[model samples]
Target: MKRRKPRILTLYVTERCQARCSFCRIWEKGNPKDAAPAHFKALLTEARRLFGRIFVDFTGGEPLLYEPLPLLLKQAKEAGLRTSVTTNTKLYRQRAEELKGKIDYLLFSLDGTREYHDQNRGISLYDTVIDSIETARRLGEWPDLLMTVTRENIKMIPHVASIANHYKLIFQINPVFSYFGNTGLTEQDVKMMKEYIAYHKTYVNYAQLRLISRGGNSTLQPSCRAVTSQIVIDPQGRMLLPCYHHALDRLDTEGSLKKAFDSTLRRWYEKRQGTFDFCEGCTINCYFDPSFEYMRNQAALLSLSCRAKYAWLRYVERPIEEAFKNRKRGEL
Candidate 1:
C-alpha cells in the first residue's frame, strides 16, 4: 500500500460566529479564543513539508470576526498556497473592498430563501448577505455559495441554486449528517436532491458545483481520509484526531506539529479510521472524495456509482453550458 498525506487543511480559526444557527454547534460551549496568525503560519509551514502545496480553507464560527484574516490570507498566498475563506457574508457589505482580492475563493453561507434561511440561521441577515453578494460582483469577485441541506430546507435546494445562478457563482449542497445530530433528511430526500442536481447540471458550471452527502458505514465504503489526506484543526491549533465531527482524542501540537502527526494518537486513528467502531462508514466529501482517485476495492466502486450520475452531468453538461454562455457574451 502507498502512503497518503494531507491535501487540504481546514482551519477553524475562531469559535465566534455572527448568527446562532440552530443546527450548528459552533457556540455550544462559549466564545473561544482565536489563534494567532503565527500559529496558522506554523501549521501551514509544517503541512507544506508533509504534503507539498495544498489547498487551505480559513473557516470559523465566522472567519470575518478574526481581525487578522487579511494578514493570514496574504501570508498563505506568499507561501505559494491556494487559499479560501468561508464566511456567513454578514460582514461582507462592510469589508468588501478590504477582502476583494485576498483569497482564491470566497464561500458564502445560505441555507434557503430569505424566510427559510433566516429561520434556520436564527438571524434575519438574508438581505444583507444578498447585498454583500452584489458588492462582491461589483468588485469582480466571484464568491461561492454553500447550503447545508436539512429536512426543513431540503425542498428549497433548487430555489437556492437559482439564486446562485443569478450571481453566476458556484453553488454547493451539503447534506447535514448524523454527526450534527441527524439532519432529518430521509432516503427520499436524498433521491429528490439527486434528481434536482441532475436537472441543474445542464445550466450550472460543473467546475462550480458541489454535492456533499451524509456520512456513515455501509458495504460501499472507502478508506476514510480524515487524519490522512484531510485534516481539521480547531481554533487552538489542536488536531481533531480521526475526524472533525467526532474527535476521539485531541492530538497535542504544542511543540512540533510534525511530532504530533507521528504520535501514538495518530497511530490509533490510523488503525481504526475505516472500521465501523471509529468512523462508522462515514461519507464526508472533503475526506472521502479523494478516495475516488485511487479506488481499488468493491466499496470504492459502489461509492462512486451512487453519485456517478450527477457527477456525469456536472462534468459533461456543465462545460457545454459554460461554453454557450461564453459565446453568447462574445468572450469565446
Candidate 2:
C-alpha cells in the first residue's frame, strides 16, 4: 500500500486587521481583498477529493473580519472537513453563535497580562480579549488559547498560564518566530526566552501530549509528513505555500493549487538537507527543519498510536481534564 500524505489546508480569508500589534507578521491596514466564495468552494472541492481526514484552518489578520466566514465553514463541514481558526478573539462574541458546531476548535491569540498584552497588541485589547473568552465560555465554545511569547511579554508567561487555568481553557505557549518584520530581539531577549522555555517545559510537554492524544494535528512534527500530507492555500487562491511563513514570503506559485503544491514540495525536498544562512539554531515549531530530526526517527506505528491516543483523549477525557487541572490548582 502507498503511504498516505499528511494534509492540512489553511485559508487566509483576508489580509485586513484592526490591531496594530508590534510583532504581528500578517497584519496590514485596510480591508485587503480575499478569495471569492466561488474560488474557495473550488479549492475546498479539490481538497476533499485528494486527502482523507482533511483539516482546514482559517486564518487572517483576523479571519472574523470576513463576513462570510460562517458560510465558508458550513460548506467545509458539509464537505467532510474538520475545521479550525486562529483569531484574536475580538469578534468572537458576536460570531460565536454562527461558529458553533461549524468549527471544531478555535485557536484564540492571547499574549499575556493586560498591561503586557495591550503593549504587544494594542491599547485596551487585553480586556476585550478576556471578555471575548468569558463570553465563549458562557456559550460553551471551549476554545483553546494560542499564546505567543516574545521579548516584550516573556516575563508574564506564568500569568498567562494562570489566566488559561482560571478560565478552564487549554493553552499553547509558542515562542515568537524571528520573522523579517519582527522588531528583532537582542541576545539577552533570546536568552530570556530560552530560560522561559526551560522553566515551562513541563507545561509545554503536557499541552503537546494532550493535543496529540486528542487527535489534533500539528504541522510542526519534525517529520516530512507535510511533504506528503499538508497543503496550504493563500488568500489569492493561485499560490500554495508549503507552510504559513513561506506563504507570507510570497514565493513563486504555479497558478493552480495542485501544481503549486507539487512545485513547493519538490523545491522543499531538494533543499531539505541544505542549510541556509537563516537556518542557524532556530526554534520555530511550525518550521520543517526543527521537526526533521524527530520525524526521521518516528516509526509508523508510533505515529498511528499518537493519532489514536489523540482521538481517544478528545472523545473521552479532554473536558474533565481541564476541570481536574483547575481543581488541582484550587481554581474550582
The digit string of per-residue lDDT tens for model 2 on 60-102 reads 7689998889989998999999898878877888888888888
Per-residue lDDT for 1-332 in model 1, tens only?
A: 66777668888888888787877777665657797788888888777777777888898788898888888877778778879887788887777787777878687888888998888888887887788888887897867787877777767878878888786666766666555665545566666766777324322211112223233444345356556666788888888877777777787666577888788878777766666464664545556665443447654566556456445554565567778988999963
Local distance difference test, each candidate: 0.71, 0.62
Off by over 4 Å in 2: 1-4, 29-31, 183-229, 241-244, 247-256, 262-282, 288-294, 298-315, 321-332
What's the residue-level lDDT of 83 in candidate 2? 93
Residue 57 accuracy (lDDT) in model 2 = 80
lDDT of 2: 0.62
